[model samples]
Target: MFRSNSTTDCVQHITTSVELTPIRNYISELNLVHHSKRVFKLKLNFPKFIVICNNNGARLLELQSKVEENWIDLQCRVRGYGIGVWLGLTDLQREGQYVTMSDACRPRYSNWMRGEPNNGNGNEHCAMYWITRSGWNDTVCKGKINFVSTFKDAMIFCNNLGAELLELQSKAEENWVDLQCRIRGYSYGVWLGLSDVRTEGQFVSLSDARKPRGNFRNWAKGEPSNGGNSEHCVIYWTTRIGWNDARCTDKFNVACKKQKEIAYD
Candidate 1:
């Protein structure tokens, strides 16, 4: 059973290396550093810099959407620095198979410069923000560059623990989970494994890619409106009986599930 005295606990199994303060605003503070010439001269490689970010309770930034790009541009304007910055994207695992360092998931959105990501010299595996071109460019991982940082999300945290968001397949299972939460005094909403991320209006289980059995739906009244056209993820809105569509990025309680072990006779 999962238990947390805190106001938020994405999942019981997923524990963070560093304590993170609960976000009070939709957008947490973005840390985009444009270090001094002396620091830039250090020429630290990608691996070394990633360690620094982790040690400081941060991660190499991942630009998942244009909103983040615009956010970076806004920061650049305020700071008056437009040099390239290191992004958390890389094809180190496999050529042309870029994945974000924050979650090892393929970026849902990318802004590659025209003819960019050419994997120049066969060594350009890391990605960087091309401020001049207003897009991304693959570059050498050994190159010295500035970087950005942001906190990780619940899904990533759960994945790190070898579990996935909870998926309710039957009314009995849903009732059991709800009962457990009530018994544990958990009152906040919790993230579920259901989502329509791949196709609008087509919900599926993240664990098995299956639809709800019997087409069971417990959506709250007038729910799943996909408010702002961004609510693709589903969550238990304060209780098990009521579900709501929400932004995948939004922070909420998480309930993860792991398959039970089966023993051969």
Candidate 2:
């Protein structure tokens, strides 16, 4: 984009620039500058605008939607400054019970940077972007810095330390899991722990290799259709009762459950 000699053309350019549909587009258009004579500088004059975080995760998705090389370029653009700053609000503070997002959403989707939501200060309730790595982190909701706020992750761990895919034994568990999925901002698919590696269409638990209870079959319409007969893994989704039959190698948000073991000795 460049400035033209004609005044009429400049009017069109400026109008198009500020007409971005999403707020993220606005941020990108503004081009925050940390040093002198670079780009548009941020001013804290607006006190009447509303703050929202529920949509932060969506921007992250858009950022990752770009090609890897392009993503690197965007990262540099944001990282021109030093530390992570607010991009949006998050609900990581509830510790599994709840999430407080910048906006109200039934189920939140989270794309936490690696090992994040580590519960910083136990008071970190908002989302921040780590400019250096272009990863997301949870920060104090009311911290000094302002404004701002996953793509599906690749599977690095082949095994879950002998743990099986999560098997929901009750309605409450299923609802809770679904809620968590939404809160994390997942709308399409989320990988579950059920697979048919052993017995072709029959799904079994990765832990005990037992067939799941027959009553609670959550299959999306025409699902488990195994379109090409190659989908052996399952992914739970809130939109569909029947989880999606996906390829095991596909990247997705994985679900892990921790159980306390009682010592008899």
CA lDDT, every model vs. true structure: 0.60, 0.44
RMSD of each: 19.7, 18.1
Candidate closest to the true structure, highest lDDT: 1
Model 2, span 170-224: residue lDDT tens? 6766776676555433444456667897778998766567776544667777788
lDDT of 2: 0.44
Error of 1 at 42 (Å): 39
lDDT for predicted candidate 1 compared with the true structure: 0.60
Off by over 4 Å in 2: 1-163, 260-265
lDDT of 1 at 32: 22
Residues 87-192 of candidate 1: C-alpha lDDT, one tens digit per residue: 7889999999899887788998899999988999889999887666788899888875322111135556457556666666667766766654443333445678
What TM-score against the true fold does each predicted structure earn?
0.41, 0.42
